[model samples]
Target chain A: MKRRTFLITTTAALAAASIPVARYYSNGKKNYPPLIMPEELGNFCEEKVIREIGDQYRKQVPQESEKAKLQQILLTDDAGKLTAVSDNAAIAALLDKKIQDDFNSSRILVLSGWVISVTEARQCALFSLT
Target chain B: MHIDARQLDNQSVIEGDICIIGAGAAGISMALDLENSAHKVILLEGGGMEYDDRVQELYNGKLTGHPYYPMKASRLHYFGGSTGHWGGMCSTFDEIDFEKRDWVENSGWPITLKDISPFYPKAHEILDLGAFEWGAEYWVKQNNALKLLPLDDNIIWSKMWHFSPPTRFGTKYKDAVVNAKNIHLYTYANVVDIVATDNVASIKQVTIKNYAGKEHTVKAKKFVLACCSIQTSRLLLASNKQAPHGLGNDNDLVGRYFMEHAELKTGEMWLNHTEPLSFYLMGDKTKVRAELAISPQKQKELGILNATVSLMPLAMSKNTIPSIKIWSQDDPRKALDTFHKYSNLDKRNYIQKLFSKGFYQSYGLYTRSEQLPNPDSRVVLSEEKDELGVPRANLHWALSPIDKKTVYTINKVLGQQIGAARLGRVKLYDFLLNDDPQLPDYTSGGWHHMGTTRMHEDPKKGVVDANCRIHGIDNLYVAGSSCYTTGGAVNPTLTLVAISLRLSDHLKKTM
Candidate 1:
């Protein structure tokens, strides 16, 4: 085979493989970044528990406008693709600080009888969309 | 010697150096303190050694305002008073409870916690509690298994509580009181009237009567009303022939400022992981447990009343009913049986089974918070008279906006602390989510009647003085929670006994 043709074919295959991976890591939305990473929740992020919390979050915050405002507060990067390449450690730290600040500032809501921080509620709100 | 007033001849006059009316925690504590003293003490009890329906009927009356436990059911008319059914939870008032906060009107007490600290050890002995120590560190150090949550001490801390074997005063001190040489206990002797001099400057004597168709007079150098708050105020208000407005009602402050510890289930705590909250759990073998209390500084900053938050297993707590709902019968015995049937006592085995499995991921939060003293919440004389011809008491229990605020803020603060520690989450009940000043129908009292004849240095401001003496009258005093200037978040038994002992000392010095 010709070297030029083989090189071009290999690069195209690699690019196609990376596209699905990026989609899997996104918030399952068309233009939004992930609000919370699964690893950030530590042992609390069981699939069943997340779905239960997501269900409750939807019940508490039914309005789309409110959900959009929460998403904006959680994801500061308007350049959506830049957030996809953002450092995982920095995102986790920022999320933790936001949860603590929500508590300090009294920005809290009760979902399924569990008093939770708005940051965590926003995460559940985003997860409910998927 | 003990005398059954029912056996005495009609119009017989009983004489003594001092006469104490009523035989409850306060009366008995004072009598016990004066045991074998030089002065002869005459102790009067309205009922016999056991519960009597006829005597209990005397306490029946109307509820004018807020929903409350029936007056007949809330108190006992027998020798031991309400101690027969008390749950035996005891804790001292915080320093903030005594101070006059700018936010809480009519708040400060003439006496501080320092004045009452000396008598608490003795009160502890009377209540069958151990070691006078209430600090959480002291209790936690003794038991290594009890671990505290990793919350900031500045925002929230553990407030320790000591449980009693629940000494029934009737059964515990009946022999001691009846056998004392200087203490003359007259059972079935209910005070009917308080007679005073022409100028009404001093009490001449009190008339006594019983269902045995007998009436008599009792004369003493000094008279002390040691009945529980309602009865004390009732007796003072009924004795109106001499003063026209009752014995100490010149300023019309006799039956005012009624208060109680507002108790209710506020919220739930959802732990991130199952926690061994041994320090917060109360078991049969556990003598001391801790509740989460807001710091004084935090309360001042928030402009809220002092409050304490208790945690329980949600599995059992969710099934339990409120005490006010269960204790609805007019008869004390029936009400108690109904309460036991529906209360957490019925789920003992279930709770034990749950406890054996260790902790759970979910818990329920209950609050016992203070109520601001309100003049409108009071006890007044009802027009309906009992068989003994004395007017029955009518209670108007009114709670304030600060009370609901206190409970709501307590649960909210606890939620914040738990979140900050990463321990768990808290979901408040629907009632606390609103800004409405009206408390929910589920709100209940601790069955602690206090502040009808409140103490103040000035006559116009209170019914009694700092020494518990009636402001305008000499040698006439009140001795019970009725003399309390303000009710704290804890139960009233221990503090009532302590203050009664203090009054005993004062009377002895004057003699």
Candidate 2:
């Protein structure tokens, strides 16, 4: 199946469950919920793993400002987000790129003693909120 | 023939064509190489066939710079020397290890790996290793189960290592050495002082003493010090009657440039999926294994020293203690016991269950790396002397910024590689995350001492020449790791024996 078709099917399947969303303004003009949702990450990892990674992320990057900066980097279309995503597949592809970019650019964190990209940490943080 | 030096009468003079001081791996290899040759070879060992408390005490010394293993327990003083306890991991040095790396200060050897390549087969035989093959592809081709990690070949490569049935030279080669017509093995014949001519141009004879109070002189046309790196330098620095500084100390480089393989657990690798990394596993049945090594180009590009990374199942590795901590007992026997106790902890059934269940796909990344030769990291003659009246060695194992940086960079690059491959993520230890150059308290060495009497063509830069002969001294040579210009990432035994055989060949030609 095509990636757009897969994302639309996933969104339809996950529509029964409520996902808490946070709003952020891009270019100080438009407001949208996070492109990648915490519920969306369930397709990749377990809830326990996400929570454990979230705890580690908070410990290593303790400052709220630093966490906010990383979250912004993940959510914003300006810096590391390489594409305009209309669905979960595009967001997943973008997340993969950001993770690779984080590694290539040395923007990595020791999450639960496993070196992981910032985008993965942000998704875990988003999962911890629910 | 084997003779106990203590049985000799006081002031006895023994003569030989070549006198090799120390019956460790190097001395024995050299003696075995000269077996049945036309020239007489005297192989002198300070300790006897068994471990002696009083004799082992001679290795006791002070550590002033870094936290290290108890000097007394770090090296064995008996017949086989430290090889009695050696784990018997062996590999040949890379071409880069002998090159004059511009980024590493005081790097490079007078002779390249090619110069010593011919002798490695003989070294492999001496160590009882497999067919002298050290490439990953060769071993991989032999075993279908040996699966290598798919990493960028240009950035990282697999370096192969073979395990020795760990041939204990004392037991395995004792008969060969004692039976050889031209090789005379002397036990408890500790060399005390080397007498030189008035000008200190050449070695005339050496004095050997034993606890039995028997003092004797051994005169030979040539002498080789194979008493390990520290003791070799100690003997040179202590022989100060003719040359007030020491024998071959005109340039004062006799006891300098000490180095060790900086070994430590640097990181953890969490695989994305469960994969049997059979190629890297080391077990009783394992004949050969591969360790991940940074390519020469990668090391040069990053300005880091040569290093290799080994993987261990995290389940057992997390419970393991650093060797420097376990090997701290003053008695080598006690230290060995402690080391064995801790090493056996991983063999429990619960650890085996963890592996069988495939619950955790994580591995501990361990580094065995080269240390840049720092002159300050050296051995000096201590004012305090041992029971033999010869001064004990004082080790100051100082490490430079490059040492810690090389380790940190290795883990970091490996992390990058894992991410690129999507294999897994690599989490560096907290100690490596900082920008500080100092090594962590857990940092340890492989107990493979080297580079005290480094080899170089120029007398100003090294104590020995390219041929392992002490510069400016016609007949004195160092036939061990003391002549090593740099200690590569692999264990030093294979290279030390290969070079010793090379030195033996040189002696055969000149004598």
Best by DockQ: 2
Those runs of model 1 whose alpha carbons end farther than 4 Å from true positions after fitting are A1-72, A75-90, A101-114, A121-130, B339-359
Model 2: per-residue Cα lDDT over B43-118, one tens digit each:
9999999999999999999998878888898888989998887878888899999999999999888899999999
Interface RMSD of each: 28.3, 19.8
The collision pairs in model 1 are A115-B426
lDDT digits (tens) for residues B1-511 of candidate 1: 8999999999999999889999989999999999978999999999999999998898999997778999998999889888877777788888888888998888887788888888889999998998889888887788898888877777788988887777889999999999999999998999989998888889999999999989999999999999888999999999998889898999888888999889988887767666758799665566778999888888899888888898776654554457688678888878655434433323344434434432355677889988889999999999999999999999999999999988988788888889888776677887886658967877889899999999888788888888889988899999989998888878788888998999999999998
Question: Candidate 2: interface RMSD in Å?
Answer: 19.8
Find the 10 residues in a row with the least total lDDT in model 2 chain B: B342-351
Can you write out model 2's per-residue Cα lDDT over A1-130, one digit (the tens) per residue?
1211222223222222322111111123322234433322233344576677776666666663254455555655645444444566666666777777776666766565556667777767655554
Number of the top lDDT candidate? 2
Q: List the residue pairs that clash in candidate 2.
A: none
Count clashing residue pairs per candidate. 1, 0
